[model samples]
Target chain A: MTDIALRGVDGLKVDYLALVRRRRLYSALLLVLFVALIAGGFDLADSRNAGGFWSGLSQIFDFPVELVREAINKGAALPGNLWRYLPAMIETINIAAVSTLLGAVLAVFLSLLSTRGLARWPRLMPLFRRVMDTMRAIPEIVIALVLIFVLGGGPVPAMIAIAFHTAGALGKLFSEVNENADLKPIEGLSSVGASWFQRMWLGVLPQVMPNYLSYALLRFEINVRASAILGFVGAGGIGAELRVAISWGTGRYDAAAAIFLLLFLTIVAIDQLSSHVRNRLVGGH
Target chain B: MTTLDAGFDLAAAKRDAERRAFRKRMLTFGIPAAVLAYLVYVAIAFDIAGLAARARMDNARILLADMVSHKVHVTRDNRFDKTTVAIEGENKGTYADDQWPAWVVREGASTVVALEAGNVVRFDPDAVRFDIPDYGVLEIVQNRTGITMTMPAGATPEWINASSSRVTVTRPEGRLTVTKTRAEVFRYFGGWELFFFTLDSPFHGKDWAQLAALAVSGERVRAGESNLAAMASDVWNNAMWRHKDVAWAIFETVLMAFLGTMGAAILAVPLAFAAAKNFAPAFPVRFGMRRVFDFLRGVDGLIWTIILSRAFGPGPLTGSLAILFTDTGTFGKLFSEALENVDRKQIDGLRSTGANVVQRNRFGVIPQLAPVIVSQVLYYLESNMRSATVIGAIVGGGIGLLLTQAIQTQKDWEEVTYYIVLTLMMVSATDMLSGWLRSKLIGGR
Candidate 1:
């Protein structure tokens, strides 16, 4: 019996070592392959690019340096330029805000109608889900550009485009939250003769409201960035102003600098604020 | 006396519940009201009321029409009295002398277009004539001075507009225009013209069955090349659409996303370790790394694209670098949080086995964090595909450049629609791909 046990122990040790060696070999192979892929892809991209990577590497800082030097030279005019662009910046924020609100409202209805167990019309749930999928699939720029052609370029076009996308994204998230919500309150509300709207409003919404708010805040952060980008594409905001300033070239970079400063500061401020609020809402800390 | 106190307590509790219910009711109504008030302000600020006047419904009509239809222009240059037929009036789509569409034919010196519903238009040497199905004959005579038009007898239809310098006749079947310099007729077609193959290609008019047969046969459509190869090369190098360039552009877009996302993830892991409180053990180092990440993120992609494009001179490289710069910050922040949240017990267990710091992290921490890292990276891969498109536009690199150029041309609505559809498909594909990977790697929740 003792000899058999010793042999079994020795066999176990050998097997364990072999397993470790195999894992190491596999991981080493994966690492090598990954490195090779990165190198090869970089070469391909460099060859295809208008400028080679090595040649452009040193010049990467030249533009920023020039921008900084010009801004410093025109320091006295910076504040005035920033002030001048405040309205456009406001338009950017308003576009984000309006779209978020409109999208969240729409998502509330769509998510409720599409959530698996809680769907009002279970038979049509797949159709609503597909509708959201299609909406989400389309890039905001496509819709924005189309609307710009039809409605002409403005904040409204950007707002509508972003809202359309936001509805799809938030609807998916909101339904996820809804699926995890406790159904007991809903059932109790319904048994007491509450209508469908009342059951959802008084029961399911309260449970999911915090998470919904958290996701909405995050969406707001993303939408702010999106709105700015759409503006650059001619939706009308600081982006348009930045485009104009940049196109004016050498002497007008100070305006461009001011816009950049505004955009950076706004993004940072919103990021910090939303992260704080989200932590409080979701983490309960 | 005790019972009375109990009753009083119950009453107080009841009053408290009523107050709480009242607050909830107010909140339910108050939030949406505030939202409504804000929207009203936005409507005023955005000038929604004036949008109607600013909108170009005519542009919409043209865009919708162009998306699904093509027009064949049968143009007669009166200066030289030379006639040509082209699709969409593009020189690339011009038909050869003998390759004109079956609906158009030349009889003697006149070119006759058989428009839909028996409407016929003839472009003759000194005159243009249109016979509408219901309306009487409309004729125009062009001289060196100007155009002379004789409208159909009786009241002229609203669709037909005539002047001394120009005359245009419009019907559901086709359109006719007469000017001193030229006379043209446009016949509408239901589908995209020359989408798969241009008129110049020998394979242009072949049906699918014929193409399939030719593809397998030993015959060579062009000398020194197989029929299949020649057909493919023709489509790829198509002058009208530039399919080869478009395919390259899409490839560039994907390359940008892949390189940027993977590069960011790689660079982020070490920086994340430096930022994580449990790993760095130095306040200043952690704080500095965190701030660096914040700075990278705060400088949005648009600004980065501009700065990078100026340095790199407009290409996929600039777009890729822009994404890399922005995503490094996001990934760093997320990775550090995941590191901080790692199960300390696992590290302790590894330590009991005499594992070093590196091994402890490798076996203990990473095993716990791998799921998160993989899922987050894949999610970004999908979203970065989208960002790459927008970045591509700003940097003048990929399909976004093609799309923007098409839209800017204002007359390439068909091309714009094509790009939009392709972009949608690409994004949806990435979304599905990432979701599949996430489910496979992390186990679906």
Candidate 2:
């Protein structure tokens, strides 16, 4: 308003944002720098290890496409070992799905213990809240590692671990959603001697169902990706296979790369699906 | 009709009462039962109290115990990383070479020994005494699971301070005696936990390490070995290990999450402005970024890592970039939500004077959001410390690469513990620094 150089149009003022004007220049520089850095790293690694860098990089690109393809054609009748691989991939996704489901169930109970809405037992609520905080503080992988011994190295342990962590995460989110809910219905129901559970089921769930789904789906997507790697500890998945390929003698990396593509595409598909569903649910409101 | 309606009403009332009672009991009993279950798990883990309270350093007891059990082996381990195997059968078609660390003698020369420490040995002078001071306790177990010794039953084991300077035992037992060297071997290898071959070595001048370096030198060591010294070396050289190819991937991971999240933050501002009631109050922008976060953070980091690794291939760049996109979506949600929560009075005052939307934001929004943005950024940085960890593991990023390596090789656990500790320190430090920055930005108010 103080500067004449700045003009107003249609009750709106236009201002130049610095980052936008430099987008082209910034992107160009970023690309150049990224490539240079990567090249330099490979060069240095190659120099130091004689053939380690080439062997490693080759594993990323060369082996699987050649050896696995030949192996399948010559004797196995399977291309890229899909027959051996697909089940593990499905199991990985299942680990994420079941974990999310279990977490949702746990979160429902945890929400009741939280202070986001009801002021029931404020003292106990804080203590319980702190407990949730502590649970969240522990990393998911750590949870998985510990549970692995009891559950054995497979999807079950990973599911339990993911569930425990997601409960902490979803429980916190649920409490917040509850606190922001339209409190009128809840209070009215309570005034009429509706029990806490009944009030929650009727007043709270209706408002927060969308939220719960959004979180559960999100957690499921993550589990699908995580299961790929969780298998290195004998958990069994794409990641476990990837690790096995890396550990194999000579060069067998292309197989890992090929499978990684499938895993990535699956994630993209899941991402699109979740986005579509979330848009429909929240937008209709 | 009146009678039927009355009966229906009575039934409904009765059902409602039963439900209420069930719920009340659930809260009273169910919650406590769950707590009981959690406590049992905690007790088993030896980490029961650390759940609610901060962890205290209590390695003094562990360190003391280690010194006694470790005595000579710990000293030899200070130099190099290698593993040792003992061979007892010489004439059984097994190659008897000095280069091979094995024992071969007449059958009469072999002697029995006590498994537990500080037990009295009732030795017959007639028995052969073999000397083997280099083997560990587990190796001793490997050697002797079941044997019928003609010697008399040994006395009970006595309790004592680990240092043995203050020996304390209630009842002493007889010791099965082996030769001096054999006794030395058993003494060297015992007193540890599961997974003895993890790469979590602590280079505190141990004896076994020196011997390993001498035996396995130069090129032979890096051939993907599975032995004790390798495990010890992994722990001892962890800091140096950070320099290997894995380190670059880790840096890439951090850069990717931070930069990508920053990108989301940038986009979030305009959308957040549009969605806010004090500003655009429009349906499209405010809600878009708000949902972006739920979409981004909802999916797991592992998902992004796998996806990006596929799209880009396995490297720090893929992992990092995946983290970037995922984190941005999350940061956008948190940022936009924070924007929505901003005090409306500032915008209202500017608007009343006919100030334009752009001007209002500059003067009103940026300053208020600065603290929130910084705080949120710091929180993401801390949160991503863990995310970075998961990303690393997915492919070959950061310390996670080391973890995968250790597992595959069946390396010593001492090194594995070291890398894990290093990771914990890194995260803790980041968390602390973020907290400090947050307080400073908020002016400690």
Candidate 3:
């Protein structure tokens, strides 16, 4: 009996060792494949690029250093430049704010329509979800450029583009939040013969409002950056101004530096503010 | 207790509750009212009323028309006395001498184009004639003394714009324009023209079944390759749509997102350890790392893209590095948060098993953090693909460059539409792919 037990234990040990060995081998192989992909991709990119990666690495700090040196030399103009660009900065912020507001409003209906168990038309939930998916899939720049062609260069194109994207993004997130909401209130409202709008407004809205706001706040932060970028492509904001200033090159480094400072500070301040509010909305409440 | 005092206290409490409810109701109305007022102010500030005047409905119409339909241009160059038929009036789409659409036929020195709705345009040697079904034939003659146009005798129709040197006739099916230098007729056709193979390709205008048969046969469409390879090369290298270049651009964009997201995640893990409260080696180190992350995050991707493009001279690498720099900060902050929230009992268990710091992290902490790390990384990877396109535009690379170029050309709206569709597909595909990978790896549904 002791000999039989010993042989069985020995066989089990061999099998366990082989399994461990195979798992390790597979992991190593995956690691090697991953490394190869990265290395190969990098090599191909470097070859196809106008400037090789290694060669470009040394020159990476040149532009920043020059900008700084020029700005410091013309430090007196910095404050004046900042003052000049303030309106443009406001325009950028306005684009973000308006888009966020419009997007959140649209998202409320879209999310409610798409959420399972709470959809006004449950049979068409997939349709609404697919529409949201397609909308979300489109890059903002594409829509912005297309609208710019029709609308001409202005804030409207950027606003519409960003809002379009924001609605889709927030709709998906808000629907997820809706899924977590307790349905008893909705059912009670339905039992009381409340209309669809009233049911959603009275029962569902209160529960999901905080999360929606938090997500919208985060989206607002992202949109601010998007608005600035859109301006670079000629949507009329600080980014457009920045593009012009930078294109002027050496002599306008002071102006560029001032704009950069403004953008950086604005982004950081908004980040801190929105993040604090979002934390309170999500966590504290 | 006295009955009167108890009743007074109950009434006061009821009054307080009613007032609070009234205040809450007022707030609900006030908030929306404030929002509406702000929107009104914004509308005025943005000059909403003036938008109508600023908008170009003609451009919108052209864009809408061009996206789903193409125009074939038949031109008679009066200067050279030569006629040409081309798709979208592009030189790359000019047909060879032997090739011409059935609707257009060359007779003697004149090229005749048959249009829908029984309209026909004839480009004779030095004069053009448009034969309308309902109206009599309109003629225009071009010579050294300039041009003259003659329409139906009764009254020139509204669709025909006639002047001494220029004549333009617009119809639902086609348009005829006669200028001193050139007389051209554009026939509208549904669908994108020369999408697969250009006029120069031997496989141009072949249907799918025929092409498939040719592919399977032992025949060679070109000197050294099978029909299949020849057809593929022709389509890929097509000068009009540039399929090969477009495919490469898309690949580069995805590659940028891949490299950036992975690189950032790799760089952030160690820094996250330093920044995390429980995992920090020292207080000042954690503080410094946190500040570094803040600086990186505050600079924003736009600034990083600009700086990197200036350095790297506009390519996928610059866009990738910009994404990497921005995401490093994001990943650092997020990963540190996740690390701080990790269950400590597992680490203690590993320590009890005589595991050191490395083993403790590898065996205990990693298992706790893997789900968050994987999910966040994958989510960002999907989002960064969209960001890469925007960054590509600024940095002069990828599909964004092609898209902007197409749009800026003002005549390539079809190409713009194609790029937009491709970008949407790319984004959706990445979203699906990342979601699938996340679920597969992290066991999240």
Candidate 4:
């Protein structure tokens, strides 16, 4: 038996090499396409009257000290200004905050409908799920545009749009959590013939609460950045200033670059804060 | 018997309390339910279709073609022979021509061959010179004044206010078509000529506000009102109304994302290989790579595009490069997790195959990851379709240029609606394409 095993007898293995052998050479060759693209982009960039890299860099920072000071001291009007963007920024966060609040309130109701345990209305679950799916699929911008016209410019339409979307997404997320929850507490309550609400309140709600809170907070962060740009349609926000600056052409790029930096920082900070909270809460549980 | 009766009675009371609490909770749930139902009702009652109709209506440029059916006589300025060219038309028409511009029209069905309306003096703003080949047929339309802009129905006054001559556009559903009136019976509003005479005010800086204000009043040229019919027509007629470019720009934007994501994948695949704990078995390497992924994903593609655009120069190149850098970080993290989940028995089998280190990875690890890596790339490509437009706006490339312009100019909300529709269409198409490609590429699990 030992001599037979030493004869290099491997098990009758499947043809593992078939995939590579039958695979189109292009599958592996796809990497070269990227190399070519990078090279091509660099060349096109190089060939354009595009100033040399040093020159482009130099031009970006060439904001004459005198010019910047002039803009700062004189204050701004419609075309060439910076000071007016503040109110819009504040309004953006306000819309984002109010929208999140509204969405969370709606999500609570949706979550109840979502739970099979509640059995709130036996026939409505499938229809309600379809409604949620459609809402989630529509982009926020599309909702904003349609609502803006009906509501007539302001943060209200934007809030409404964001709220609907958030509720849908949060509802879906919360339902999955509810479905995955431990049934021990509910079962223990039910063994005594306790009602469904009593079981859910003591069981499911508590279990899913942490994930729900974490989700809402993260959503608030996303809504804030999106709200900032709604002003392009005159909905009122910091996005108005951004639109104004961008419209002025390459001349005003630096100002926009500055705004983008702040927006980026805000998102990063929120993500870190939310993640930390979620970890702590989950760990404790 | 007496003790059992007391225990049963206590159990019955407890169960009754639980049932009562459940009933109360169910009753309270009605409040939120009513609110949701009301909102859904409101959504339907609001008439989104009518709103879309109105948005398309307002995008008109107020066709000046019929109202100013007058004529302009372009003549060389007598004061300085070489410098100023003069056009003789009605006072309102001429002045409007100067503030806006008149498309070149000939007396007959010919081109505006004999004349240039604005002067060529160094100080005065010159007209956009069009080289007409012959007096075949030149219906003078204005030079690219308000490139068709799309506004959402929700557009505010801030979005509406825009430069008279420089129209910015955006992405949405339908095209907002504005034809610079092929030069008609129009003259400069300020003077007979389009330019403020260099001979007269060569060095003097004209008060810019009065001129701009004069330009916008009186229906701002009273272009034709467009509904779906107007929009449909504009799609074919307007210079900026072409859908192919919009479609292609969207495609280019998607391509930029794919390239960027691929670039990220290339950089990431190697890093992910090392980052996976199973492969690296080193805490520091894995942690560092994980941090890089977190940081990359944390900043959105919109900001990344802008920042990279600044670091690199402008154009599609910057947008693509941004996609690459951001994708590299994200794909690295995602791919690393996928890499770590791979089967270890395959590694053992690869070793027994007398495979070298490289061959072992090819034979063992790669096969396990092929479907997953491709799936991720396909998914990110789908995501980047929308992201690319937003990013493109900051960078001044792709369809986002139209999106920025439409919203900023507030000339037409329909165009904005059109672009949004197009984006959804683009995403759906790509989603379908990618799904098919993924299934085909993987050839099943």
Candidate 5:
């Protein structure tokens, strides 16, 4: 009886060791495969590239150095260049801000219409979800380019394009927040014979408002970057100005540097501001 | 005395409650009012009123129509007495002599174009005649000196614009333009023509049933390949559509996103440890590393793309490097934060097991960080796919370059539609893939 019990314990120990060994082998194999994939991809990209990776590595700093040198040489005009592009910078900011506002409004409706318990038309929930997915999938540049064709080059195209994307993105996040909301208030509101809009406004919004605002603030930061990039494609902003400056080549790189500085400062400022606000809103909760 | 004290306390509470309610009311109304005022200002600044004048409705109509339909141009060169029928007037889409569309018939010295709804345009040796259904026939003749138009009506309709050098009659069905050198008729038809097979391909006009039959049992169309292979090769190499190039571009875009994202995550993990306060060797290293992250992110992807493209010249590698540089900063920040939040008990438990620092980190810390790292990486992978498109545009590679080129041409709206559909599919596929990967790797969280 003693020998049998000792053998049973020994058998259990052996099985445990085997399991651990198998897990380690699998992990090691996965790591090797991942490394191989990365190396292969790097080689493929290097081959397909116009300039070889080794050659390009040495010249990577050439453009930046030239830009810095020109900016320093034209140091006196730097402030003036910044001032000249201030309005364009403002336009970019305004595009982001207005699009965020419009998108948030649209998102509120979309989220309400798409969320399970909150939806006014419950049967059409999937339809609304698919709409959001399609919108989210489309890159803003695609819409901005198309709208730029119809509407001509301006901030409006960028605004509408960014807003279209923002609505979809924020809608998904808003709906997720809505899913976690307390339903008792909603039930109570409905028991009181409140309208769909009233129940949502009075009950659900109060619960999800903090989360929605935080997400919107984050999206605003992203949208600012998007709007600037759209401007590079001729949606009209500091990006358009940057394109013009860069196209002038070496002599006008000072203006380009000034624009870059403005863009960098603006992005960092907004990033810091939004993160601070988001922390307050979410952390306070 | 007790009743009087209680009543005074109740009155004070009511006053405070009323103040709070008033503030809430102010907030509810004030925010919307501020937003409305700002929108009004934006409207003025962006020139919303001027947009109506600036917007080209004609262009919108053309884009919408061209996206769903194509036009075939029938040209009759007066000097050479030669007639050619081409889809979208492209050289690649020009029909062979005997394979012209049935609607266009060559009879002796004239070509008759039968358009929709009884709108017939005939290009004769001397004159171009357009017979409209409701409106009377319009004749345009180009002499040595100039072009002249005559309509069988009291006044020439606004659709007919006749100048000395050119006479153009535009209709819903078709358009006829008569010039000194050539007389052209554009007949609009639904669906993209020659999208699968160009005019030169033997499989150009085969229906689905015929194609399937050819694929299964029919003899080979070319000498060296089967009918199925021939058909696929023709479609893949179709010059008008460039399906092969498009596939390559999509692959390049995905490659950019993958390499950029994975490379950044790989580069960031070690840096994240250096940046993390609890794991850093010293305070200065952490501070310097954090500053490096900030600088990397602050430069932004746009700046990085411009700088890198100048170095790498315009390709997927440039796009990948740009994404790598920007995302490294983002991943570093996120990863370090995650590292700071790691449970101390796990590392302590590993230490108690007689593990060294490396072993402790490998066994204890990595497992704890795996889920967060995987989830963040997957999320960024999906987002980076979209970014890759934009970067590809800047660097002149991938589907983004194709899209921009199509749009820039200002005439290839159908191609634009194709690219847009492909791009949407590509991004959504990546989105779904990343979501699936995240769920699988992180145990459905």
Candidate 6:
């Protein structure tokens, strides 16, 4: 009887050990494969590149050095350059801010229309979801470029393009937040014979408002970057100015540096500000 | 005394409630009011009123129409007395003399174009004639002196714009323009012409059923190659559409996103450890690393792209590196925060067992961080696909470069539509893929 009990325990131990060994081996193999993939990808990219990675590495800092040196040489004009581009910088911010606002408002409707149980027409939920997905799938540059063709080069094209993307992005997030919301209020509002808009406004909006704001703020930061990029491709802003400055080559790099500094500072400021607000909003809850 | 105290407390509660109500009321009205004011200002600043004047409805109409339909140009060069029929008036799409579209027939000196909506345009050696269904026939003749137009009718319509050097008659179905050197007529048709196979290919005009039948048959389209192979090669190398180049561009964009994202994640892992307070005992190292990450992120991808493009001279490498540099900062910050949040008990448990620092981190910390790392990296991977398109435009490498080039030409709206559809597919595919991977790897988080 003692020998049989000992054999049973040994069998169990052996099986457990084998399972762990297999798991470890699988992990190791996966790691090796991952590393190999990275190395292979690097080699492929290097080969396809116009300039080889090794040769480009040395010249990576050349532009920045020249930019810095020129800025220093034209240190006296730095303030003037910054001031001159201030309006363009403001336009960039305004694009982000207005798009965020418009997108958030649009997202509120889309989220309400798409979320299960919360939707006005529950059957059309997938349709609305697909709409948002399609909108989100399209890159802002695509829309901005096309709109720039029709609307001409300006902030409006960038603003509309960014807003279109923002609506889709924020709508997805807003719907997710809506899913976790307390349905008791909505039920109670409906019990009181409230309209769909009233039920949503009075019940659901209050619950999801903080989260919506937090996500919208984060999106604003992203949109700022997007708007600037759109501007680079001819939609108007500080990015267009930066392009012009950079294209002028060595002599005008000072202006480019000034614009870069402004962009950097603005981005950092927004990043810090949004994160702070978001922490308070999320943590206070 | 008890009644007085109760009453006083009730009064104080009522006052507090009233104050709260007032604040809520103010907020209900104030936020929208503020938004409306801001929008008004933005409207003025962005010149919303002027936009109506500057919007160019004609451009919008052209873009919308061209995206769905294509036009074939039939020109009779008076100077050379030679006629040519080309799709979108491109040299690559020009038809050989023996094989013009059936709608366009050359009878001796004149070429007659049968347009839709009962509109017919005939391009002669020295004159162009347009026969509209409702309106009478309009004739424009190019003489040695100049161009002269005779509008059939009671009055000259606004659609016909005649100048000394040129005469243009525009209609919904087609357009005819007569000039000193040439008489041209454009006939509009729905659907993209020669998308799969150009006119030069043997498979160009074959229907799907015929192509499929031919593809399976033993007979070869070209002597050296099979029918299927010949068809594919023709489509892939189609000069007008450039399907092969577009496919390559799409791959390059995806490659940029993958390499940039994975590379950043790889590079960030070690740096994250150095930045994490629990892992790094030294404050200066953590502080410096955090600052470096901040500097990397603060400079923005735009700046990084410009700088990298200068070094790499515009390619996927520059775009990838730009993404790598920017995302490294983002991953470092996110990873270090995650590292800081790691449960110390796990490490302590490993340490209690005869594990060194390396072993403890490998066994305890990495397991805990794996899910967060995987989820974040996958999320960035999806987003980075979109970024790669934008970056490609700046660096001149990917589908974005193709898209911008198409748009810049200002005539290839159909090609632009193709690229847009492809880009949308690529992005959505990445999104779905990343979502699936995340769910699989992170257990449906």
What TM-score against the true fold does each predicted structure earn? 0.94, 0.51, 0.94, 0.54, 0.96, 0.95
Q: What tens-digit string does per-residue lDDT give for candidate 5 at B323-415? A: 999999999999999999999998999899999999999988999899989998988888889888888888898999999999988988999
Task: Please list the residue runs of candidate 5 whose C-alpha ends up more than 4 Å from where it truly belongs after superposition.
Answer: A1-11, A248-251, B1-18, B78-80
On residues B285-328, what C-alpha lDDT tens digit does candidate 4 reach at each position?
88987888877766565555544555556666677667776778
Error of 1 at B277 (Å): 1.0
Docking class of 1: medium
The regions of model 1 sitting more than 4 angstroms off are A1-8, A248-251, B1-22, B136-170, B177-180
- The 0-to-1 C-alpha lDDT of every candidate, in the order given, reads 0.88, 0.54, 0.90, 0.57, 0.91, 0.92
How many Å off is the CA of B68 in candidate 5? 1.9
lDDT of each residue in A144-228, candidate 6, tens digit only: 9999999999999999999999999999999999999999999999998999999999999999999999999999999999988
Better of 3 and 6 by lDDT: 6
Query: Can you write out model 6's per-residue Cα lDDT over B259-292, one digit (the tens) per residue?
Result: 9999999999999999999989999999999999
The fraction of correct interface contacts reproduced by each prediction comes to 0.65, 0.05, 0.67, 0.12, 0.72, 0.78
Interface RMSD of each: 1.1, 9.2, 1.0, 6.2, 0.8, 0.8
Total colliding residue pairs, candidate 2: 60
Rank by TM-score, highest first.
5, 6, 3, 1, 4, 2
Which docking category, incorrect, acceptable, medium or high, applies to candidate 5?
A: high
- DockQ values of all predictions: 0.72, 0.08, 0.76, 0.13, 0.80, 0.82
Q: For model 5, state the Cα shift of residue A243 in Å.
A: 0.9
Q: On a 0 to 100 scale, what is the lDDT of residue A231 in model 6?
A: 91
Error of 5 at B265 (Å): 0.8
- Residues A1-285 of candidate 5 have per-residue lDDT tens digits of 666587798887897899999999998999999999889988988888999899999999999999999999999999999999999999999999999999999999999999998999999999999999988888998999999999999999999999999999999999999999999999999999999999999999999999999999999999988888889887989889988888733448999999999999999999999999999999996
Cα lDDT tens digits for candidate 2, B1-445: 3455644687778899999999998987996688567546534433334422432222223223332332111001112321122211112212222333122112232323332343322122232222222311211111222222231234322321112111111221211222222222222333432222212233223466664764466444445764445655565344423433444544554554454455445556665565555555566665675565555655446545544454455555555556666766666655666777888788889889999978888777788888888877777777676666666666565656565565344323344444555565666667668788788878772
User: What TM-score quantifies how close candidate 2 is to the native fold?
Assistant: 0.51
